[model samples]
Target: MKRSYGFLLTAMAFTLVTLVPVGDLPAQQATASSAALPFKWEELTAPNFIKAVELSGGTCIIPLGVIEKHGPHLPLGTDLIDVRAVVLRAAQTEYSIIFPEYYFSQIFEAKHQPGTIAYGERLIWDMLQNTCDEISRNGIKKIILVSGHGGNNSFLPFFCQAQLASRKDYAVYLFQPPNDPAFEAEVARMRKSKMEQHAGEGETSAILAVRPDLAHQEVATTQSGEDLKRLESMKGVYTGIWWYASFPNHYAGEGRYGSREIGEKELNHQAEQLVKVIREVKADKTVLELQKQFYDESAQPLKTRQ
Candidate 1:
């Protein structure tokens, strides 16, 4: 299934090249700040949404997150809030119609903890399918999904791949923040702790930047966020209960190292990458056409033999 879907995406990649405009770069707006973006989908008037779609070239972003616990300091909706914040900033810079808060994602690991609203597997699949259908119905040709939750690492890819179960008029693109050694170095140098995963230094710093008032820096040490090493046998081999075994509290890492400076740097880098993807998606041409061709060919596979 992965291979077939990968092939479809590959085919779309080739097709998108032909459909999208590619050439000279435009003179960027030098003075514009990300603060200029429309904060909510409903904020745009009916007339403005039309203009928004045109400006975005029918491309839209769905910043995915989940409503779950983020250690002891961060908010339950931390991932949703932060992901949407970055998407909003990116859309402001690049002009894509942003979908509002989307917190429906995989979080079965956190179900035991408070405020963890993990949907069932069937519901998760249907929710995503309906979301894509609804977006396409709304005239968005390309949908970019950027997830802020690590728990969705598997689900998001599976969701994207399933788009090819049958052909559709639109496309789905999922991305993680691009790798940048310089950014990594910057984050490391800015960090006060060595291992900051989950509700730790990095997440804390990010929340500090976006919403500092919400950060409980002093109370971060109230709970031990370290791995209890409870599931010692599961380390060598993976299991479904690994997360529960290590951190039953659903908290990992210390938030003491969080700072606004690091948050700003990381977020800025993420927004920049999102903006770049927007530009590339806008210029892309082949995805739709190839999807059509592939759909046509799939009806008669015997004729596709070499």
Candidate 2:
């Protein structure tokens, strides 16, 4: 399969430096039982990788994240950190090979903020496409995209749709967990802040629960996360600059009001939902079968049933 040249070079360089040859390990360690294998792709031995692919039934997850600045209180990698935490928890229940930290995602709106590593649109697209290609090449044909960053909300779905633009041996599935009314109502009752977006109460609480040492709730009140409503008049029209125009400080919602209890509850709920998704995707064959049928039809439209 074709891959991005730049990504290929980087991947080659990484493999050369970090990976030990399968033959280098002792015979016993190289042939260890699958029960001792780790779910993380990077953590698995070269030989164990094959076992993981088979154990997972060719299912693998790419927990997508972006390095963007959160509010003053939360770390720049809050989204990635939080999302991975949930993915890891779910993987513990439903085994799947988890990709390493992937922060190549859309973060153009947060470019104005410090510590935001917003790559060009083409680079991010190529990186993700090539990453998926590389994973599939390794025998894991069912790739699951579980995005932690809100910025990827649009990009991921579009990527999945674009897969149909051509024929692919592997299938790409995006994990979109539906909201549970009971959970939302519980969150509403626990939520102290009225506005909870970005590094707000919900996000802050999440960080506190996962990595309390990094969360600085005391400084959360240092910045204002309230919307400026700068472009309220253009309600019907959509513009790229809308996020920056409203939240110039790149901070939204009150983080000081976040609590660990709420964060733990939210994370558990998300993990539970993800566990279910992983199981469903593992058992699913219709998507790939349908894609094959669609591709064959697309190859010759005249032959398709009217």
Candidate 3:
């Protein structure tokens, strides 16, 4: 009988990670139990880290965000800040190791704007793949990728699909929260601005909830958030330049009506939705089992049933 190398490495990592003295940990996290260990990966001492792996049931989350210009009013790190807030709140209820401030992601559409850190296409692909692999190496077998930037919608799915290109001991799950009608109705009833998207009313409200100082509501209306109708006749067509053609300033929606109250509602909804996902992922076993089956068949398809 052959022993598996992956298992051996995982066991060794777990052993070493549990050796740190509890006294060496920060005062806030020093006496905390498995249930109380800090959710942020960097905040956990080695001993607590192992406990976290157990507490999370080998589950973790990468709250993905991007460094890009968010209109003229919001800070460049708006996406990163907002996403972190949501994931941190969710983790409090669900108990998963949360990766810190991951802003390296697809953002070519905002390259023309200031403070956009758009890594090369290949680098972005390799970086994300390597990050997931590293997470698995550290004993986390389930990874949840939750992105706050809307631009990553397409890129994340493609990345998840590519996991099948090789046999992986762990599984990657993307968190795509749906629009709850009740939540939407509540927002709509209070929303004064009809055109909020990026730095618009909704986004500004979210920021206000997280970092009210960073959201300059008064400056939000300095620039136009309305679409300029640059590609009207080519409605059915799609092109890379479509976003820039319409909203070159990268501003969308009116932010003047943003309120901390509205922001609180949106954040609560997002965090609640993510908590549900964390629970589901922790209980999921079929995905990894199916993945293993697929990998085994792919290795020798002739032996598989016809």
Candidate 4:
């Protein structure tokens, strides 16, 4: 049998979009589980790592984020900090090996701002590839990238697709934040205000839930953080400058409208969805089987008569 990289890409993307949460665990089984099962890849002892790998079904999540200025009130590591908390909590529920703090991601868009750590393009790509290679070497076959930074939206998908550049023993997956009818209803019920963008109500509320001490809701109004109308005409067409033109401060939306309750709801909901994905990936056999077949077929294209 032959395999193609396309099969791997599709499998990786499929692993993300379809999430199904399982309900409850037996008391004895839950009690027998190890605490290190949730996170800190380094913390898992050599012996325990075997168990962790099996528990996660060879699936691990690399919660990718970036360190950048997030307005006057929010911490510079807002994205990293928030996503880690959610990933850890999710792992607790579904049991997946959680990679440590990895803030190396695409953040060139925020380079003009202070406290932004943007790695060289080559380094970012290498870091990810090496990380995956190392993980695969360690026996994990499925990797999920749960990205929190808005800037990483394009970078992540592109990275996942590029995995097709060569044949690999492992697959990469990325989960979109969940969107359920009940969950959407919950968000509407919890939101106290609607802010525009950076450090806005939604983001602020999220930080408040995960790290209240760092959240300075009182100073949220210190900066306008509003649309400056620098390039209103650019709306019809999307350009890299659109963000900078509209939000010069790199901050938009209203922070005062954010509340811890809303943050908790968003974070918890995301965690719940993540739990479902972890479970599914653990039992997934179709992707691996299809990938093998495609790879085998690709090697003998001449024999594949149409």
Candidate 4 lDDT tens digits, 131-245: 9999999999999999888888888899988876667788888887555898777787767655556778878888877767778877888887888788886557777777788
lDDT per model vs. reference: 0.75, 0.82, 0.81, 0.76
Let me know the TM-score candidate 4 reaches against the reference structure: 0.84
Off by over 4 Å in 1: 1-39
Across 1-306, the per-residue lDDT of candidate 1 in tens digits comes to 111232223322331121122233232222222123343555667765665565566787888899888888788988976787677666655667778778889999998889899999999889888888888887778988999999999898988878777988899888665689987997788788888669888888788877776778887888878888877865478888888877876778879878888887877789889988887877778877788888888888888767
Which pairs, if any, clash in model 1?
15-286, 16-285, 16-286, 16-287, 19-285, 20-284, 20-285
Candidate 4 deviation (Cα RMSD): 10.2
Candidate 3 global TM-score: 0.88
lDDT of 2: 0.82
Best by lDDT: 2
Candidate 2, residue 213: lDDT: 74
| Backbone clash numbers for all candidates listed | 7, 0, 1, 13
Residue-level lDDT of model 3, residues 134-251, one tens digit each, is: 9999999999999999888789999999999999999999998887898798899999987766888888888777777677777777888888888888967789888888888888
Q: What is the TM-score of candidate 1? A: 0.85
TM-score for every candidate vs. truth? 0.85, 0.88, 0.88, 0.84
